[model samples]
Target chain A: MLYTPHLTTRKIMPEMQEFPMLSLSSRITPEHLFYIRNHFPYPIIDMRTWGLQINGLVNRPLYLRYHDLLQMHQVSIPVTLECAGEKRALFVPKTRGEQWELGASSHAVWTGVRLMDILKAACILPNAMEVTFEGMDKGVRTDMQGIFTYMRSLPIKEALNPDLLIALYMNGKPLPFRHGYPARLIVPGWYGMASVKWLQRITIIDQPFKGPFQAVDYVYVNTAKPVETIRLNSTIAQPSDQQVLAKGEHLLLGTAISGDSPVLFVEVSFDNGMTWQPASWLDPHESYSWRRWCLKWTATNSGTYDISVRATDAAGNVQPEIADWNEKGYGYNAIQKIRVYVD
Target chain B: MLYTPHLTTRKIMPEMQEFPMLSLSSRITPEHLFYIRNHFPYPIIDMRTWGLQINGLVNRPLYLRYHDLLQMHQVSIPVTLECAGEKRALFVPKTRGEQWELGASSHAVWTGVRLMDILKAACILPNAMEVTFEGMDKGVRTDMQGIFTYMRSLPIKEALNPDLLIALYMNGKPLPFRHGYPARLIVPGWYGMASVKWLQRITIIDQPFKGPFQAVDYVYVNTAKPVETIRLNSTIAQPSDQQVLAKGEHLLLGTAISGDSPVLFVEVSFDNGMTWQPASWLDPHESYSWRRWCLKWTATNSGTYDISVRATDAAGNVQPEIADWNEKGYGYNAIQKIRVYVD
Candidate 1:
């Protein structure tokens, strides 16, 4: 059993737990404290019998055993995986899903085989528009009563991006039984939903895949644009939500990661978003890894304030002061607002 | 005799007018077009007859002619003088006083000897608690009717600070007739109230000065804290109030001045104050000089917006999101909001 007493657990069926402020604790989250978000209980698997099936819109419908897949190639890549409903607690009228605060995200170094190499070996058809991944774990969702496996799809070009990986190990060790054991798909720049765990099947489709998680669950139907990549964001660690401190000099620590664009600069505002100061970087910049940052703040007055943090990416995308709200409360990256009392 | 066609001249007796946004024209405001905020008609005087009398609690009561005062060692320093009621027009319910907008302040080079030297020469008496200055000009009041001069005072220590000066020159030339021709008192880091024009007499007293400008007029009785030194502030210049422009990349220029502190950073928010971008500097930094800054904004969407600009100073004072309201609309330095249409 993973010892993660610090993380806030919102539910047990899906086994959702949040990561603590890593900038305050450790730069690389240990496997035990790493956040776990599962749609179903850990599936029992035997490496000898476990195999991945690649069909539909492929020149060759190929089936590769787990051991054979691992023998092809191996590389290590650090990636941050965030739940679609990362900050769902911010929604008004109370969103119906897991009401997460600041957890539901984690970073890990995965030793894996290139997903691009497998797709090339399977000879993906030219007509393929999308690629769908199916997990081995199955369960009946509370929202819809039906035996189903968690599934998601990505654009064909994104699915074949060299950044994609099929990992057989976590943090240098063979993958843990609960973390897919034999192998799992690792989609670099998409939400954790696209990184299907307990992976077993892959399908190339000529049109958008209508999986439950794709069509009915994660999409923000109310908004004009559907939710996809995680919005650029950063959060304060030392002054947790509703924390208190004496008026004096203090250091604020946090971490930030943007999906498609590299995190350019992270700003911390002591007085909401009225004025902001750039937080100094604690870690060298990286695309998929969360950058650790901290800023020295001299709290001059004693009053309540919404200490906020927002990030801007190289792509000119500013973390909107207030992220647009959705019914399911998906990508709620409105400047990570933490109210605190300075006395 | 000075040509300033764009200034809104409110009265002929007092000669009250405002400077146009010079960021759209020039950086250092031309002496001729500098905003004129007179409480009374400009006082005419012969240089030989103009003598500054030092009396009351001073160790030696002395009178120095204008020529004798100019003979003292002098230094040039940049100081921004902002009227206490700079942007009073923004107040609702129509606060009394000039319904001025964002043009009542300007920066200038003041050449003079430090007021500290004069105090040292006369040997300020220990009993003195405040030092008062009375301008030569006089007028009848609208709020409190009675013949009165534009007089104000400050604490003895503040009045004798090395930064305080009796300026004899404006922009390297002898002061213009309308701007206190022979000499004027410059109280750095305080509102224009402390910088009395057409200086005539200085009285060091054992109490806080209680002239109409000091007691009944300038003070905001409605608020717990009396309105004082110009609040930390900034204002947009290029995109004039309620101006319209095509949807494209536009540069916004502005200026910010603080009383006791140096302007540190200025921020501009197009969508009210929800989001802000750091504006770039146009000139070298100078204490007391209104900094010239502009930011390149690509207006992608077409709509009306209240473009806002707020500034912070090195002393850690942030321009309040909203200025405190008062009956007289004094020290209106809230985030300068300008509504504009983009088509």
Candidate 2:
């Protein structure tokens, strides 16, 4: 038999220090772990040349260098960072791409100044319906041709939440090179993709930013329908990636969140998508981030078993058994099914 | 002025190596990063004396040594382990407790022998309604006088899930001392409290295990009520414990799950509980585990602000703005509000 540690006693060495935590525990420490995601290579910004241009739908166009931004009202807030597709690697059914085993999310304490403060300095415009942010990352998708720059936009109303900011430090320290240093945007409760790194410009426009990063990519579509529709989805993040288990009774634990509404409950199935049982909630702190839940199950037979999990939000949204597959594989929140073995 | 990183570039580290995706990117390797949650010191068992006794309401009492369990049908399953209060520390109300900043959860490839196989060997009695598990950890709570052994119980139907097991190893290795070693219960889709570490005995009973661990200790009650009522709640895991942020447009992201039903949606409020907005779902995967979601907000003012998040499940279960407070802090899914600042 392949010997493996039980769930309560597994020991794994971490690759990096400063594992992020909401509080602290013996099992998880600050130095041993935490996941990191970067959209652009760390930009080597010359503080002298780093200037933020706020124009477009605004009444005033202002150019604020790094020094100018520093001179503005400085603020710090505790916020969380989540990848748009943190669990996408696990949702790829039969397809091999960036196979992330559910470890793409994290939290941190950000310290910086608010974007609204800078925008206010430039006077608000009347027709501003959306706010667009441009980053310094320069890359192109294999299927696309242009040297695509990473950019994201949000409704102007969302741009006014008091938690948003332009960060320069993390965890009470200078931003690391791997993490966007010098400057970055912090969208307190949105996906990490919306929080553009190496931020350079903020444009207030009457319409949403129709950039490659926004309209072309990161959008989910129905696999059975046309590619124009965008739907919502969620993912699980607790069970390790590619985990092998000797099943009897096991707790299914992870997190879930939604776009249209607040997550209500999480469901689990052990009988190859046959029966699903509601998992218990550990904490449903917010609708914007993942909620933690757990299900208890016992392994009765010995065979390769398929286990699947899905979620529903308060808005009556249930995770589809199969997400509409889009060409870019944007929103793949289909029922996440895993194959395990009983002795 | 404080400078925080952009929410887009900020990354949330997964709780464990098994979980590798975030709102934006995936962790590069499993070894360097991963989350871990340990309940007690790992125990070493002598196979000769370390026998599992199945008694109580069973038709036949059976005492099987560790070796005997190995001889029985062995099982393995991939599961996730999470602390009930992994993100409690981030609550802005400043509850009196060990503030966990997140990372009190983890996923692992667990290998173990099936519990049902042994239960069948003992011949379960017809009147059995619950199964109780006993572990080696013993402690005394301020409310209780005598030294109490750690134990928990599950309904007979839940104990019969085909994925549950008696985990012996984790991540393809012997159980670590910090985690439950020798043997432990792997109750899939439940909180870590249910998966008793250092397991020593299994008892079948017609009554629920009303021990301190179940009734008084690991339970939650509405503080406003008589503290006897049980209330449900949820948590977000992505932004991660005390994440400092800069003021501007940002995304608040995390995962949530529930025990009674599937998570429906997550909501966020930046103005100290003045208004609420729904977060976007990144993946609608398993409801038993975690669901990923995010909220987009732009900081308009610069000051210490309270950000709150709440969740609702498919069954119309909304995380209460205030949960009943129990003596033992369980079910703390009240609207988790965080205090952040913009410059």
Candidate 3:
């Protein structure tokens, strides 16, 4: 009989768990192992009266009750979600916010109504340039100065892509409570922050949305484009980082994925960029799911060794060696390094 | 005393040697190890009479002698070059062509006059969509029905980018006879095929080129755009692929780079995608140079293991877990997979 690795969840306030890179055996990361990222504690609401409103610069404002969406045309897509700060624990000198590793990302089948259809039904006014989303998960926080509801927006064009959705189900079932029970916005290609949970209201505006989350919080320094794409990335899982092993042969395991395009190749180096060998895929890859790969290494001498991995995506983007340090340490995709001792 | 890895160059007809991934220690790969990929044998010509002519759909056809270009305003930039089939050997079912492994690529500092400057001097006529380059290395081939000179083109806009150059020197010295002696086209972000060597003429045309190199060969099936950017990629040199290592402390060595962007993170997997460990950088990275990284692995057991490496560029492009196989095997950037048995 084969043995399956168990999920690893760490104890934290808003609730978080670092997905062990080893359990990444399947394409769609099971909902149980999916990492959870929340700005505030989960808020529970009565499903009966929970409604999503769309107003502002719209010819016909929409007031959609959760039930109305269920009656509309439905669609599903395998989408991957990542927090603005996924692997922040690896950041040196430390940065503020959740110290997540690769556990901050996961893939699931999202079933919902097309966001474009909703925008069209609202009859977007001519001058509308952005569509904003407001979630029922409201709260006062140290960072978001005033009373605020978790909100975010999309450019008019991006909102029109048929792929974007106001999701009502996750992994073939009703949305999980911790994952926004009634409905949630699923911005396919962007980070998780843009996917407002517990969706409540949406607004179309001509000027850029200046709410705290949009105007300041999610950005790094003055870089306006808030950690949008999941940077070309990979994570090593087996022969656990810094683990002591007996001198012999062992297998190296890990996962790699990108948001902009498909991944092309992954190479492993044991001598500091001197020479690299390729890794084999363990599972078929989907655009949104992280790719699993492995390599066979024969360790002869008993001592400490340094190993490295680098990946390049189909769009021809190469992972950088050093990440540009940001105060909040969002989007930490720098090449990972580690040391292990041998007996 | 420390052991320094030596560069490896395989013997072949057009005179080829796989760049020892180990000796890839510097930003500009040393001259000797740069992969040698020539369509035809070197063509010798008197430098005094060598002139670059600009004609076809142009208001003014200009002819500039070699000496004139040497005296004109010039610029030097670090650019990387890669043959269309750089990693062809890695393709499955083995496609037709050189069957190159990874040595079909190299980095160099090119000194030349900006291609934009020369194009402006030609006074381009209206409706010029493409700019073509003709080289002096004329020869007859099985692919070309008759005798033909190597030529390639760029969309007018790409030709005007100041970064594109009419290179006269490589790595602070006159271009080597075997490496496009007098002058050559240096297309900074494109594959090596676009940089026609031993240049002679420049022509602007309104219609798409139907040349044998562009239409029949250098392409995947009937697609038009000949492999442009080098897909984000990396290679390991030290501890050569499939090398037997003594079970002890060792540093995994390798290099990663991208033609279109700077590399981001690189990770090493010791158990496929199930686990990964970060690798450390051994040298500072530059835009065009492959980055050097090292990771420490402690081999505690004896068995066969597959080690894999993956990289991401700053643009957020991740190395794909697989490569789309092409008939000519051009631009193959599949994640490198290697097997090593540790004793």
Could you list the iRMS of every candidate? Answer: 29.3, 19.7, 25.5
Please report, as a residue range, the 10-residue window in candidate 2 chain B with the lowest summed lDDT.
B1-10
Candidate no. 1 TM-score: 0.49
TM per prediction: 0.49, 0.44, 0.48
Better of 1 and 3 by lDDT: 1
Q: What lDDT score goes with residue B77 in model 1?
A: 86
Candidate 1 lDDT by residue in tens digits, B163-233: 88899998899887777767789876677877888899988899878787888877887864545676788
A213-327: candidate 2 lDDT, tens digit per residue: 6775566544342222123454444332223344457666665656456677778876866787888887645534455677777766655566678888777878887655543
Off by over 4 Å in 1: A1-5, A22-24, B1-343
Tens-place lDDT digits, model 3, residues B141-212 = 643247788888888988888899999988988887667767899987677888888899999999888787
The residue-by-residue lDDT of candidate 3 on A179-239, one tens digit each, is 8779899988687899998888899999888888887778876365576767888777665
lDDT of 1 at B168: 92
Q: Can you write out model 1's per-residue Cα lDDT over A191-241, one digit (the tens) per residue?
A: 788788888999999998887788887888677455678778776766555
Q: Order the numbered candidates by TM-score, best leading.
A: 1, 3, 2
